[model samples]
Target: MTEPPQTAEPSPPSGAAPAPGPAPGVTADGGPSPQAPAAVRRRAVLAGTAVSVLLILAIVFGSRLLRDFDSALLPYAVATVFLAFGVAYRYTVWISAPGARRLFRQGWRSFFSAANFRRAPTALPRMIATYLGFQKFLGARSHARWAAHQLLFWGCLLAAAITFPLTWGWFTFTSATGSGPGYEMRIWGFEIIGFDALGFLGWLMFHGLDIAAVLVIAGAAYFLWRRMKDRGAITGQRFAYDLVPLIALVVISVTGLLLTFSSIFLHGGGYQFLAVLHMVSVVFTLIYIPFGKFFHIVQRPAAVGMQLFKYTSRRTGEGEGEVLVCRRCHEPIDTAPYVANLRGTMRDLDLGFDEWAEYCPRCKRVLRGAAYLDHVKKGFK
Candidate 1:
């Protein structure tokens, strides 16, 4: 009888069960159960997807507005701001990193070194030949890709050369010259030579862009698909930096093609719109250039230049005889003689070896030795 009474003494209030005692998967404090970390990740993915969609829509609509706006000043303002930002970013990065700053100093010192100009007179010629002639003629797989990149780069440069001068008449007329120079001379001298060249190169560049876009998009898509298909490739810490550029590049390519071919179908008298959008895209690309993966364009060259100078200095008996350890193979090697020969060859070629570290005519890696050897072996085979 006592045991039966004790059994009825303490039951959890109606539906409750001691407030669950913070259950197996729950945090302390009697609140709703905690969610799985995966749930939070899923929520983030959804949010990112929504944001991306919004961005795409904004780019589409905003680009259209570029045409009808009566603001002639906006384009120039945007372009200037973009250019300034790029310069500022580069400067900041260059100054902030000790390695980068050291490289810059080395590069500058090499450029002005008496030995560079005296014994290395042919450096400049060698650089030009290697870059323009030999690299172009050999058509090595890597070299070919580089040439295509250069073509697009130069085309963009020329297009900008034509656009700014024409847009602001900065080259044609200035405060110094009231009415400016004659139109015919400007057209013949600047337009035909500069603008026409840009246009022709731009047309060629469009083809290059198409090819590049296809390759890049294919590569990125393959990677993304692989991440989904292969569990081994998936990691918890997937970087947005990796995906953003790939997506942006795809958008750029698609938009560029639309501007080229689909404008007429989509909007009446949309040529102006296309032009403005193209210009805006170019500006956007420039603005992102220093911050994104595209920063490689600037950095690669500088890295190459630094390597070139370092090698050349060692070879020419200009360094302190410190042996270089190959980063890849961990092999210790004296770089002096190789650097000397390279400098000599550069002198003979009349190219500035110090200026073009990014290229190695013999090996094609930024620096000579093991990595270049590896590249050669893999590339040729």
Candidate 2:
């Protein structure tokens, strides 16, 4: 389960200083952390059990309700079931991955540690800004790509927030007499809501999705242009990788807009067809979420783990494990174990000529440049 080796070259010069590694005492015993106490384990097991039962009931009833509305919606019901199953399956796989379990344990311990409590106040806001609000971490030098991503991210966020609940049967709509197809959006079968209401909240409930759809279209367009027009940016990406999500988003947004148009101009005259198209596109997208780039949705918790374990580990200052520092930049890069695995992999592949893992990325780039210059000098000689 070790990470692939990063290098096969000789170790750093003996004179180089070793800096702080990952969390000190993270693996003092040279093995995984001890299992939690029985009581704690039992409580976790019970809570997980209860949640699983509720989820099963919700899926069963939710599918039944959708089926009652229209037999054609069965495809959507099936897709939902598959999506749920796929999410659970992927989570299990992630948990079983190397270092993942240990990372989870460390993250949980860090969260509950009394000394770290003071930092908690700013953590949530910072995390949201870094990972969700702005996603500044995505591209170090690519502003155009990042802008396109931000549009897609917010659009999908808005769409999912509104769509999931209704699709799950937590929300419904009731058609007015002779309205003939379109219906008033309702929450929990009690509150009558729709675009018809002449107020701010009403306008949002009805038009929020439309706005989101427009954003998705814009984002998808940018993405398509990048893939087709800007070849360098999308190098190494497969055609399907570039097209599937883009196509899916465009179809979902376009169908949604078309449905709204049919409802307003045609007085729900072709609403049935538009609804069917919208439903199919949406269901397919939902099914694709856990399996495609949308799978990033399920990795949010891991983002928190990255913050907890990687960034905050050395803060304790006790020195539990060997920390890897960039010999040139003098910046902490990773734990010894992490770099060891990478070095091992590269060595195995005969690609570790310069011991690349010994240096941080910036230093690695500098080293590569120096090597190139030396080669050029030799050629001139």
Candidate 3:
């Protein structure tokens, strides 16, 4: 009988070092042999701290600019410009990029394709999943966190959408009876929607907004504290992006809550000042949205759409061969370099002539072939 072909030796266990003993000061688990220098970490923390301080200053002073604008028209114009620029930037970077656009197309195809529709059957379940799984769909955070974020995100969006049309009288659908169609529609819709009972809804929405604001502010604050306390969480480079939105959100939330609840507490002449301050916060937030993390609002959805389209296209065979699968985990590997490395490692490992399969190094499980193929179809370039 022919001898079995010689099999390569298995790789050393992941945590095992080649040497007989751990390297000097190295952990037994074979993690990095050297810790980052304490001085370097300290500097990083200090830098993040400074950026956080500057961000706070910017928001505090930026809102003041809105207070000085005497004509209400200019603030609205500024807000519109900011919103436009933000949308344009995100589109160009994420939605219009060649790779991203391809993915976006696939997403649209997937949504409109008969196969997907037949598989899903009802639109309501898909809609509910979309609503509840926003963060998961975006790959941003968990469901609960995403839900909290959506409350603030949609609230702000809805508020802005309604405010603009109602305040500017933009729609032409209503009778041209001197009173703007937009205004008439707003009143009609509000009444018909039982906004007369909006007291409860308003309270709920505002409370939700307040909670979201707190969460965002708390996250920022934690980052800031980490910069000061832990020193490991920051890169030390101070960019406007680092803390500006955090400060802005905090300002907006505090002022908004005050405007609604504490307006009566303002002393003598302080009422006017407080009212102006509150409005200034609103205006500043509107203006800042385009320039900050808030810009993610537009970019995220497009990203999701692009992802969907990319998956659909691959499923339809508009691209290359079978998607790469992880040999160790048996799962589909994306174009990620690390994943490629894992596959290469698995192929090098002689595993008793079983067909090559993708696998997750972390879990070390052989992913189902069909599932792996599906993943590749969705994410492979």
Top TM-score prediction, candidate number: 2
| TM-score of candidate 2 relative to the true fold | 0.65
Stretch of 10 with least lDDT, candidate 3: 188-197
Query: Per-residue CA lDDT of candidate 1, range 1-381, in tens?
Result: 223445647744556445644233222221112342454445544554554455434433433433322255356545544555454534443433444555566666777778776877777456545654344533564564454445444544454554443443333311224332322214212333222223555455335545554554554565455546666545431444344555555565556566656544766456667666756665676566655555554555564456557655665764565554444444544464444444455655577554443233443354555665577675545
Prediction 3 TM-score vs. true: 0.49
TM-scores for every candidate against the unseen true structure: 0.46, 0.65, 0.49
The C-alpha lDDT values of all candidates are 0.49, 0.67, 0.48
Output the lDDT of residue 349, model 2: 52
Candidate 2 per-residue lDDT, tens place, 1-381, comes to 145547876555556555645333433322212454455445544554555556557755654544423344556655666677656554544444344555565667767767766645566457768877788876675888788888998998898777666555656655675452445775545556444444666667777889999999998999898888786855555544447879989998998998888888888888888888888888888777765567667767677765765445455444765677888987988866446655655665577464767888898888777887788565335
Candidate 2, lDDT over the whole model: 0.67
Q: Which stretches of candidate 1 lie over 4 Å from their true place?
A: 1-73, 124-240, 246-257, 260-268, 271-280, 318-381
Order of quality (TM-score): 2, 3, 1
Measured with C-alpha atoms, the lDDT of residue 51 in candidate 1 is 49
